[model samples]
Target: MITKDIQVNCSIVERFNSLDSSGRLAHAYLFVGPAYIGKTETALSIAKMFCCEEKPTAGQLFCGQCSSCKKADSSCHPDINFINSDFGEQIKIEQIRELLAQVRLRPFMAKKKIFIIKNVENITLEGSNALLKTLEEPVGDSLLILTTSVPEKNLDTIRSRCQIVRFLSETKQDLAEHIRTHYKEDEITSQYFAYFAEGCFGKARLLQEKKWFEKKNEIIDGFLFKGWNDDSIKKVLEDKEQVKEVLDVLLSCIRDCMLIKHGIGQNSLINVDRKEDLKGFADRFSFDELVAINGEIIKTCKLLSENLNLKIPISVIKEML
Candidate 1:
């Protein structure tokens, strides 16, 4: 689905439009960026544009009323295919073979068949080799779009074959403002999603849908402020998904305390709702101590990303306090 506000990813669409207008569209494209940053959405939008029966010009977007647009929007378009890979699982060679076979056929309806492979970095080396054959030989009336959060994991040959498009992340403030204005969110709600989502609108929307912001006070007060007790850590660790959320909140709280120590304006603080409490916490530590704590928190977060044992990192964080 096209996101509610797509201005953040308009550059990709504009580039595609220019290419389509000039009749110079590439056979394959690689859209690389952080997860939930609109790479897939942009690919889907471009796919719809390619199939739009209205035949929009360079400056115009797809007409929603067209049969092709309706089918694409409803995910019923035969010519548009989305191949999704689950987390931690590599795309199989059989999947690549199926994709190759499908791409060999002519479009069922539209002028071109579009295949969007999400998380292409997860493709196994064998699968990558199979996919490479198709990329080497341009298939008839087909467009291949591959997306990956970690471009470094993708094969260099595959990367070289496609026209690479790099997506930039939005600023926290800009995202907060967008959420507040477009979603009719309150200032705190808007700021919460923006900070937690790390400037990704799609992530913000998912967090909102999950009502994750409701846990803000509980998480901060329970584990963060009191220096992550055994019970608090246990609760957080029980749900592996919440591990990152807890770390993000802990990092933000520490940063807020640092800001409070420096007498920074309240508006600059991420956890603005807890300004008074953070100020009190800040007074207990020296500036250098806070810096050290911040470093530990950053280190722990990195270790967690690498799938290291969380207990070791948590123990180190506990010692920091």
Candidate 2:
């Protein structure tokens, strides 16, 4: 029997299985969706179909007990390759050249050679174009799986060569339940972090981490009650990623405050953290004034990322209130 616990997208799974049944699977596939939506997992599942020794008896897929499946699980499959980079650095032309050179060779143990590339967007322009050529004329039994959080960041030429399978963002309830179950958090916190996560497990994991909770609460309190003071926001600003997240949290909270001013319920608020904090602001600022502050957040977040004077925006945002 074919069984999967991880909410297998039935339609997508069907299409993939049908392709294999007809012996007409595409050479390249683009799995596009928000980060942490299991795009990588789905690609790995499909790769198993190409390499698994024990074929699925019920459906079109690899049996979990196969040696190839074990190899994939161990991340040491000779015929399967996975690569990603932090920035747009790893997918350069040099890497593409070497990978393309290898793709031409026959598979060692499996009938198919599979290359799974993560962060397709980070593949530089020259590298993407180079990849486009191989994608254009794929080897007879080779499959390439490209996964990206931002497929739009990749070159159109590379995108045009692949069949795109889109993953839907999980619901807050579903995602939160999953996190709470696996992460072992209190119910209220699980719900809180779920809403705060905005439907991304990667973000949820970061938000739910105990190490960050105290710091995050302190930051939220800093914005909610404290004067828009230099000493307050400056603490988080010390860390680039923390600065970005705190700013983003502020922007989102202010948005909630605006909605509340316009008669949106607290129940409807998106940021699960510090709703009372947003309420505190909504009580102090008018809807229009809150909106103006929200606009400042947009501008400030941009400037901060561009390495602009952070203190200036912080002062400006405070002064706007």
Give candidate 2's error at residue 161 in angstroms: 1.6
What would the per-residue lDDT of candidate 1 be over residues 57-157, giving only the tens digit for each residue?
54566766789998998888999988888656778999888888889999998889999999999999999999998888898899999999999999999
Q: lDDT of each prediction vs. the true structure?
A: 0.84, 0.76
Alpha carbon lDDT of residue 230, candidate 1?
81
**Residue-wise lDDT of candidate 2 within 1-321, one digit each (tens)?**
243535345456567768977987889999888876667767777777678887478754677787888898788999888876654456778878888887998998888888988888887778887888789997867889898888768888888999988888878899878877878887667776777677777667766564555665666667666654677667756777776877777776787888877887666666555676667678988777887888888988998879876877877776766
Among the numbered candidates, top lDDT falls to: 1
**Error in Å for residue 314 of model 2:** 1.0
Clash pairs detected, candidate 2: none
Any runs in candidate 1 off by more than 4 Å, and if so which? 1-8, 55-59, 224-229, 315-321
Q: What is the TM-score of candidate 2?
A: 0.85
